[model samples]
Target chain A: MTTLSLGAARAGVELRSFWRERDAVVFTFALPAVLLTLLGSLFSGVYEGSTVTSAQYLVPSMIAAGVASTTFVNLGIGIATDRDNGTLKRLRGLPMPPLAYLMGKVLLVLAVTFAEVLLLLAIGMVLFDLPLPASAARWLTLGWVFALGVVACSLMGVAASALPRSARSAAAVLNLPYVVLGFISGIYYTPIGALPDWVIQLGSVFPLKWMAQGFRSAFLPDTVLPQEVVPSWEHGRTALVLAAWCIGGLVLCLMTFGRRSRQTS
Target chain B: MTDHAVRVRGLRKSYRDTVAVDGLDLDIAVGEVRALLGPNGAGKTTTVEILEGHRSRDGGSVSVLGVDPARGGSSWRREIGIVLQATDDAGELTVAEMIRHVARYFPRPRGLDETLSLVGLESKRDSRIRRLSGGQRRRLDVALGIVGRPRLLFLDEPTTGFDPEARRQFWSTVRALDTTVLLTTHYLDEAEALADQVTVIAGGRVVAEGAPDTLGSRDVATVSWRDGREQTDDPAAVVARLTAAYGGPVPGLSVTRPSLEDVYLDLIGVPR
Candidate 1:
């Protein structure tokens, strides 16, 4: 009970602190929708060989990009700064469970990721004529995929946060790698077959590609599946891959945060 | 149950090969204001962190509020408040918001308004934390530290950067808390003014521990004249000899006890 209440309060504080910065608010919510329109319109709104609109592909891909953009950067840079600033040390000394602090960051990013996804989803479906999830079951799949993706990305963010020793370097370390993840993971358009097998392996190993594929499986029409590298909506494989990333990312987050806190204290 | 709020025996901590706290022992009775006095890099923070359970010690038997901090759980933590040695991290929340949020973590907390008034931040309650001045931020930190209504409070270098007036105000605030305060400070005056007892630590070991007024020849005056200074066992004897030599009161003679700073400097072996 205490953990839950503390988490709620932490989340409240995190959100208030987060939204106070106008740039962070715009970057997390507005940028994804704007990117979807620009990229979708630029690509002529059609997949290379399919009748499906390119917006449909970007709807899922850019959402993953958006999650990476905000949650990863937010968790990575925000937390390292917090650690450097002694915020984590102060919170660790509190009576609350240590996980409450972690939960607060995770919950804040998850909330923002949801809002980003919804704003993009609404734009994709309404303005771009991106198809809606066909059935209640499809919507349920979208729900789980969204939940898992945000969590996995946020966890990865927390884990990666420890990479940069100081707050000043965290943004560079965090955002630079994200561009690579997006490139290979088709967060932007790529001819999957033209790419080397190592690229496929690399993208599959991280959460970005799998999370994007999972979202596609839930939201994209069946006809667009061939355009995806896997050539079919491998829903089971998508779940397996995303679940692995989610669990693995969570473990990594716990270990990295534990180690960093010990060192700082 | 122990009558002491904190008890330690032979506490030890090392970072890799550097021993930070070497076999240090301390005891603080319940409701006592005990100050850990030492120069910087004298393991003051390391020792306090060990007690606060933020860092693990290599070897020691320690108890805080009757529970070993190393093994202490959430309920044990609830009984103690901690004011760290760093700046506040509220970042953007208003003064009241940060306090309210921190208060939710404790099982029993002081009222929000009451805590604000206690720290004299009621006037700045609506202001963003980033806009607060250094002293105001420090006061907010103390406010958050005590809002949980802790029975024992650990204040680590609480007034390190305050101006004279601010420091005095902070001293009074700390005195008014009415809780067992175990504070660490390098300022001898802070220890002299706020602590009932002061323990001087050097090289990670206690050199002396006693009531502040009686701590180290504090009552012995060092007689000084135009030519020399003498730390005498008997200042009156020195004074009488000087009076006889001059056939009256010694010219430019002044008798003064070593200030706490002088004693502290002597304790830490920083040549005076």
Candidate 2:
């Protein structure tokens, strides 16, 4: 119980530190909003024959993509820097439980991801004239997707931190997944139908695809999109798959991060 | 009367193919400031880390405050404090905020104002941690270690980069704490100034352990005058003889015992 409280306090401190940097806030939230606006306005080709606007289709995916990038790249780089500076080793020597330290990091990821999602959604609604979901059920689905995306991406960030020996290398490793997934998950473009079958299958195994799909369900009406072999917005299956990825990611993160800490110490 | 704050029997540790701590034994009583002096890679840091429960030993029986640190839980950790060599500088929080945040983890902790005053940073309580000077930052590290009012504290080369004035101020702070302090340093003067007992480790083994005044147990003393000098086991008798010859106190005469550094250098077999 004390561990949990300590973790929450430390997480608050971490969040405050991150929010103090004006450039980081801009990079985390504003860039995604700006990109969503630019791409939504210029890319009407996305829904030429459909009834949905480009903003309606692209904003949700961008929101998902923004969450993923913040969790993986931002967190991965931050932890690596802490390691390089001996901050992690110092914390290990304290009386606090190991879980407290990890919980703090996880909470930091959650706070940042939430801020990013809200900012993107606000921009989409106010500036791009995108409509909110019509019912509480649809909004609930969106919430589940956002929550699962945070867990999966934060765990992936912890896993990626182990791949690089230094902070710079960790940033490089993190950027790879962020850039590739942004394209493969159709954040900047609508390629769900055009992507190769195997590529889509592999993407389905990850949370990004489900997150995008769930967001689309909330923002877009079913009548406008083309009929596919299987509908993208099956709420039950999307939640199940994203939940599974989150669990798998948690296991991988615990194993990899604990092992790395011991080895380095 | 003999309850040791720390007791170790045959401590040994290895890193893959290389051994770090090798069959080391030590016992330090409560309230004793024991200084572990050695060159780099002499296993000082490794041994300290193991004692702090941050590293595991291959073999050892280490009882710190009546419990083995290797298996000690959070309760045991509450009794000990460790000042690491470096800290995270990313946070924009002020020193006061940082201390308050860490204080929540301990069962009982010193007040924030007392801690700030103890570290001589009362004026900088509102200053951001990142804006502090190097000496001020190190003081913050010390402040954090003592804020919990730990029964035993480990300081690793605490004053390595400090200027003379800053180092003196740090020594005063350590003196004021009056807790059991186990420090490791390459500076002999620091040991002589602060340590009640000194232990020198060389090549992963204890070379000597005793008070700073009589470390080497060398009986010989040097008697010097304006003209010449002589070595003798009895410096007082020689001083009396010299005074008689000069028909008064011998001019510029002095009897000198070996300095702790000289004895230490001789024991470690390093050419001065």
Candidate 3:
């Protein structure tokens, strides 16, 4: 078989193992959807002078968070666990190419992230009356934002996997940043404008904030524009920041991934 | 294509100020099962890792399957298999699934059923890897190593934690394979059982190299007769002289040579 097909087969294996774990499947797929339901119900009123309710505004932001969970958090802990378990060493001894292993990981992230988004979107539409993109342009924006967000987060996760000393510490290392970024990036809070200026500035430095903002522009109406941190959606800046992170993240991954000297045993 | 599956000259490796392997030389002919017998910290693992391409030598000319291991790539990797000392990977996958997944990496892998049976894991074929006992896990390690049908296999302390029965079974499995094997072991009996040639190493160098029965000065035999016992290089002559003296079948007569363990300890500088 060709390398691509072999990589696909590896993806199948990875997916099978992932599902069989039970705990990981529930944690990765269910967390964001559960959070969306509770948060959307608790914050019910529409924003001032706009038809978009707090829950409607939250749907898009939650979608962004779901993407991060499935890609960044998933790959981070997964790779670290693989390293600790001697999977990396065993694969290094085989005839398999490094690219094939990478293909398998990337494909796995893409698949789980796709499923995560669908589940979140389904909950948003069913529980909070969230609407789908109304036009091809809006759909295009969603497409590019989802694509860029998944790439940047996945790369960062791969790079961060090396930071933890072992698999036992991977979740603590990766989740600290993930949870902190969600709150500051306005996934939990609506109308990011309401947060302190310093908090807004801090959130602006990360990709999650830009991803949430991009998703808001696609799903929310212009009437809610006055409540945004910026007067406009600033789609140009959103694309630029997320795109830049993609490049930077890829560089970091290439530098740190698989660079550690493995034990000789 | 080379007559020797592995060849090394002046192999050297050091960690900081401590030297691991110092000017070691080795050669293994195709289809030869050579046992590298050594104590801990004697550079046996270092030498094997360098040859496996898992490590780099400080200075040496080393070749396995006619390629410098430091530069060995996927094509070179295809011709060799490695069973590491201990590992706990692929625990989530069933035995059959993990083996099948690994087999896809090679051009001509053994059939899954045949591979499982070869390692005596047929009963655990559908069981999760994490559920297997320690010995069963080691057998799985061996199964994965040979599934690719590699021409040369490197087994590093392959039976470190096995029971006697399991070790014997493992030796039989290794013997069944028609491939060149470089086995690093501490068990003299295991070496005697499986190796065609035994190389005893100490201080990162070969102290003795020969067949297991003749590795050290095994030519000296202890010839016992009814009168007494004598250590002699010419056991046949001594026995004939004793028989003539007795003028009949000798009583309490037996001839014995130094055991491999005795010779191994002497080579490694350990007092009996």
Candidate 4:
């Protein structure tokens, strides 16, 4: 009972702080939506030898891109800054469960990711002629794919925060790789199959690519499957790969959170 | 001694190869404001962190609230509060929001409004922590620490950098609190004003320990008058001589003792 109340209160604070920071909210939410709209229109034409319009192909990937950019940079930098400022130290000094603190931040991540996803989807459907999931099964698949992406990507952020020297550099240090991976994964304007084999293989190693694939499986019609690196939806492989990242990312988050929590320096 | 809030014996800690704390001991009685006085790098923070269970010690028998801090868990954590040395920056949390959030941690926390007013942040309740002055943030630190109504509160250098007015304001807030507080500070004057007992730790050992007024050896009293001044080892004798010379109580008479800083320098063998 204590844990629930404290956890709820902390999540409330994180949510409040998330939206209250105008620059961060605008950058995290608006940038992705704007990027999706801009890219979706600029490349409205279909790719070579494929009937799928760029709008349908890019929309699903951009949804994953939104979750990735927001969680990877936002959660990573948030944790690093908390450590640098002694806010984590202060929280460590409390009787509150550390998991409660983490749960609150995770809840905030999901909330922000939801808003980012909604804005992107709305823009995709309204502005770029992207279709909504038409069946109960399709909606369910989208729901779970989003859930998997959020958990895996956000935990990946927690692990990556260990890379930054301090809070000030966290954004630069953590965001660069996400930017590079986003570009390579065709989150911007690159087509997946159009990229060189090595670049596609490198993208495959990250959860971002798999997340895009999973979303594509749910959102894109069967006729458009050839554009993916797999040339088939590979739904089982998508779920397995994303789930593996979730479990592996969970282990990394625990390790990083534990080591970081014990830090007094 | 049995009712002591803290007891330590042969407390030792070494970081990498450098000795941070070497064989330190301390005993703080219940409800006493015990001040750990030392300069920077004097192992003050390390010693306090060990007691607060934030850091581990290499060799020591420690008891805080009757449980070894290393083994102490959440139940143990509930009995103590900590005011971390200010490192600045708490994001955009407002004064009230910060207090209210931390207040939810403890089993039975002090009232949010009560803690806010106690720290004299009533007017600044809506102000974000970034907008607050340094002293105001320190007060917020204290408010969060004591919101749990802890039996033992550890304040690690609560006022490291503060203007004279701000430091004085902070001292009053400390004085008004009802819990036993263990404050670490290098400022001798701060210790003199607030602590019921002062433990001077140097090179990770207790160099001196007693009430601030009685910690140093007896010394001469300095007397000043309108025209002249005198220092006599025996203040009573000086007073008698001055009274007799004036044929009554001395005129424009004033007495002075060495400030704690002076005594501290003497104890540490630093040339004044």
Error of 3 at A123 (Å): 1.0
Q: Using alpha carbons, what is the TM-score of model 3?
A: 0.92
Q: List candidate 3 stretches off by more than 4 Å.
A: A261-265, B222-230, B233-257
lDDT of 2 by residue, B1-272 (tens): 24799999899998888888899998999999999998788899999988998888988799898888888998888888888885655547899988897787788999999999999999999988889988898899999899888999999999978999999999999989968999999899999999999999987889999888767775579999998899998899999988899999798888888888789888788897
> Candidate 4's residue-wise lDDT over B1-272, tens digit each?
56899999999999999899999988988999999887778899899988988888899899999999999988999889999887665558898888877777777889978998888989999898888988888999999899989999998888878999999988999999998889988888899899999988888888888889878742567888776898876777777888888998687998888878887887766797
Which candidate wins on lDDT?
3
Task: List model 2 lDDT by residue over A48-120, tens digit each.
Answer: 5656776677888888888887787777777876787676876776788878877888888878887788888
TM-score of each: 0.90, 0.91, 0.92, 0.92
Q: Show pairs that collide, candidate 4.
A: none
Which candidate would rank higher by lDDT, 2 or 3?
Answer: 3
Clashes in predicted model 4: 0
lDDT of 3 by residue, A52-160 (tens): 9999999999999999988988898889888888888899899888778889998899889988889998998998898898889999999999999999999999888
Q: Mind listing the fnat for each candidate?
A: 0.67, 0.67, 0.67, 0.67
What DockQ number belongs to candidate 2?
Answer: 0.61
lDDT of 1 by residue, A51-99 (tens): 6776666777787788777788788877887888768877877888877
Worst 10 residues of 1 chain B by lDDT: B84-93
Local error of candidate 1 at B60, Å? 3.4
Model 2: residues >4 Å from true position, as ranges?
A: A22-24, A191-205, A227-241, B218-220, B224-230, B233-236, B243-257
Off by over 4 Å in 4: A47-51, B218-233, B239-256
